[model samples]
Target chain A: MTSAEATAHYFKKAARIMDVGERIETLLAAPLREVKVQVSIELDNGEIRTFDGYRVQHDNSRGPMKGGLRYHPEVDSDEVLSLASLMTWKTAVVNLPFGGAKGGIRVDPIGLSSKELERLTRKFVDQIQDIIGPTRDIPAPDVNTNPQVMAWIMDQYSKYHGHSPAVVTGKPIDLYGSRGREAATGRGLLYIAREIARDVGLPVKGTRFAVQGFGNVGSHAARLVHEDGGIIVAVSDVNGGVKNPKGLDVPALFDHARKTGSVKGFGGGVPCGSEELLTCDCDVLIPAALGSVLTRSVAAEVRAKIILEGANAPCTPEADEVFEKKGVLVVPDILANAGGVTVSYFEWVQNLQHVTWDEDRVNTELEKLMREAYERVANISRTRKLPLRTSAYVLAIGRVGKATVLRGI
Target chain B: MLDQLMKLPMCKGLSQGEATELASIARESQAKKGTVLFAQGAHGDSILVVLEGQIEVSMSGQTLAQVGEGSVLGEMSLLGEGGKRTATATVLSDARLLEIDAARFQELLKTSHLAALKVVANLAQVMSKRLLAMNEKLIEGNKGKKEELADFQKILSNWSF
Candidate 1:
């Protein structure tokens, strides 16, 4: 399925359970605005290259829209729109005071030089600066974009809107980024895993964990799980994967990845391909990398008793059905990977107040919000006899639906 | 006498002899294009049947419909108590018209029971169709207002503030 269809699949499933009717479903699902602009930039080589950039302000009923800015070759209007609506649900699921919006450029960031990338970012900011502000749609880091990219966006956006640190989150710490924002998604996964293990009787101290995609989300998730005494049996990145049934050394793997730029050369365990790592020998499987990795076929081969989706839309609808039949507990991405946006919200709040929160305070506040959101969804899942993903979606859609209705939409 | 003038809208179920008897009383007349056969709110006591050419029905100077042969004009004035035209009728081209006075038709109904009953039934059916069309227009206009009021009720029930 296309990413848009997959996200809508989950939305419709929950909307059906809520019985919100087709009219409200259409209103809630439709984005408020879908904007696409040509970002023409003069490259460092003096060649003028124009790129397609999109920003979908999905909903702003609760508050201003908030989401990430992704820089990838596969970025298109459909994926951006899907991600934007997903943000709407994610923020509502977490009970944040913001709605959802997402932006992306269809050019691979890796292919551009530093100068070219900066010019592209500035031009993109110039194209959309009028629509985005601290109180409007705020952009964060996603996919190939990082703190440097966010910093550039902030600097360029400031040229038009003036010094507005709250306009963009996930910048360098010196440039107003939050301290815990870097590891928020992974840390949120840790908190949720603890809660699930406590209920399922699989203690975090000994639960075997396999994480696919050891990037910003996967690596931190693995390390945090390892620190909690969970066995990190397998982990993978885009380049390669590593596996050890006895548990790979998480810190050593991090070192190896930092030096060699991949997990392929890690000496702690057997080298595995990224695809095989999904069905790795572990009790808990975390697909924190790309979306749609867990299809019907993959779910059939998956032996993991619990699946934590630290990536957005890692499991397709068919895979979800397969897992349902097999009784695999799936912690959805809106709740699992929502830590980043949750912390980005913190950063935005801090920027708005002209203050910086300490790392400990940031982590504590994040844990509190994460726990509350999980408890709400878990209670509905247990009582309603619905899947956790559906439960979370139902809760999210209910909140957003209420907001839209109450606000006179 | 124009045979087509016997085909008045209110004479739908009348027999050939009955229609010819009614047409025998209609005084034939001719008017040029753009002539006002009847006007909105004007009192009338006769129903005119168009035998040939087109006539335009309008309201407040806006043309509502362009009608041709076999069309009836001012039928409502004969049936309604006020005997006032609801809309204006203007001749679109030089045409034939058969004007039947209301008092003469009333006198004919006294002697012809079956023909009067059939004509009254046909007029009632036409009047009912126009009534239904107006009802539909009323509903269409109120749709937005209904939706807005629904949203208000929902909020009033569920909204705390």
Candidate 2:
């Protein structure tokens, strides 16, 4: 399922445990705003490539709209909607004073040159600038998007808003990006995993973990876990994966992956398929790559006790059902992967105020919030006797619901 | 009094006298424990510094550290070109504080470039040291975990935790 379908599916599941009155259902069914714009950019080849872009401000009942702009070949309204919805819950899940939104273009960012990418980003921002503001909707980095992309978006947005740095988060630090943001997502993943492990009575040392994907999130997660004394037995990337029964050297693997862009030829372990990387025996299995990696089939064969989702929508509803039956504990993406946004929130606050914080403050603050959120979700799971994913949704929805009610909306 | 107050590192480099002058530029307020001084991520015109007692640095409700007795809590957001309060600083005890507007802080920096430079340089050094320590801590903390895990794995080579 796409991020949108996964979002709707999770909402439906969470709503089952909620009051879900007519008013609540109405609020949850569709986004608060869905913006579609035509982004026309001239390619280096002198041909114009027009791409449809979307910025779905899912909800802003809590505060401003916060999310990322994805650039992928599989981008679509449904997927964007799902991600937007997820952003809403993810922000709420972490208790950030914001709502959720997500945007994307259909074209592949990798196919675009630096100039083409800048032109496309600027055009998209120009079309959507009216709807986004520091207090309205804030965008950040996502798949195939980074600080540079954010800087472009900020610059484009500024052309209309008079150099408003608060208009965007995740810009280059020179442009108001927060320190420690590059590692926030991975750090958040490590934090969530640590909390879950503690609750499940798994010692951090010698705990085996398998990570699928060696990109920013995956590599950081692997390195952190390895640093935390967890034996990272397997790790993968787009090319393939590597596994060692004795535990892969996360730093070495990170170095190799950085040098090679893939973990296949790391010379430390035998190569394995990305699919097999998920089913490998380990205490924790983190899917940090693309979505749908943990479909129904893979979920059935998976043996890890915990499934911490780093990638959005890595698990489909069918896969979720299988995992539910297999008694696998799944930390839903919104809660499990909210560290990035929490830090992004910090970065934005820093930017708008022209302040910078030490990384310790960032990571410490992140750990405190993520752990507390995890504890709350885990408690809800136990109290409601619901799965973790469902519990997370219920917790988030309930928080947002309370806010909506308190605001008399 | 204003000139002397400006000499403090946390003052953002107003001469003690300039800080006093700048302090007069905004509303002065006193807060007690449980008083919400300012919240994380808030952008406004004012910056607060502890004049007496203590302020607790918090984010998402957890107290990370404390600021007390002439320490600056909100200047990070005031002196920088683009800044906002990254963490909420709550009054940990009944205390006196000087709240200065962003404009006044900038004005003071402009009026006394020497004082401003000194203040900026001091904050820069403090932030740099803090950041370096945090980075090393992050790496070392992880290394500690890894070492413990390796030892555990060695022990568990024949058993389990």
Error of 2 at A94 (Å): 0.6
Instruction: Give the interface RMSD of candidate 2.
Output: 21.3
What shift in Å separates residue A400 of candidate 2 from its native position after superposition?
1.2
User: What does candidate 2's lDDT look like per residue over A1-409, in tens digits?
Assistant: 6655777878887775564544465676579999889899999999988999999998888899999998988788887887888888889888999999999998888788999999999999989999999999999888788889899888888888888888888888777888888888889999998898888899768899999988878888888888899999998888888899899877787788668777898788888789998999898999999888787887888989999999888999999999888888999898888999999999888877778898999999999999989988888788768898887887777777766655754
DockQ for every model, please.
0.08, 0.01
The residue-by-residue lDDT of candidate 1 on A98-174, one tens digit each, is: 99999999997877999898988999999999989999999999888999999998999999878999999999999
Candidate 1: TM-score?
0.79
Worst 10 residues of 2 chain B by lDDT: B152-161
Instruction: Give Cα distance to truth, residue A32, candidate 1, Å.
Output: 0.8
What are the TM-scores, per candidate, against the unseen true structure? 0.79, 0.70
User: Residues B1-161, candidate 1, lDDT per residue (tens digit)?
Assistant: 53574456677767788777776777988999889988898888888888888999999989899988888877765554536788999998999888888877777667766666687689889989999999999998799656754654463344221
Top lDDT: which candidate number?
Answer: 1
True contacts kept of 1: 0.00
Clashing pairs in 1: none
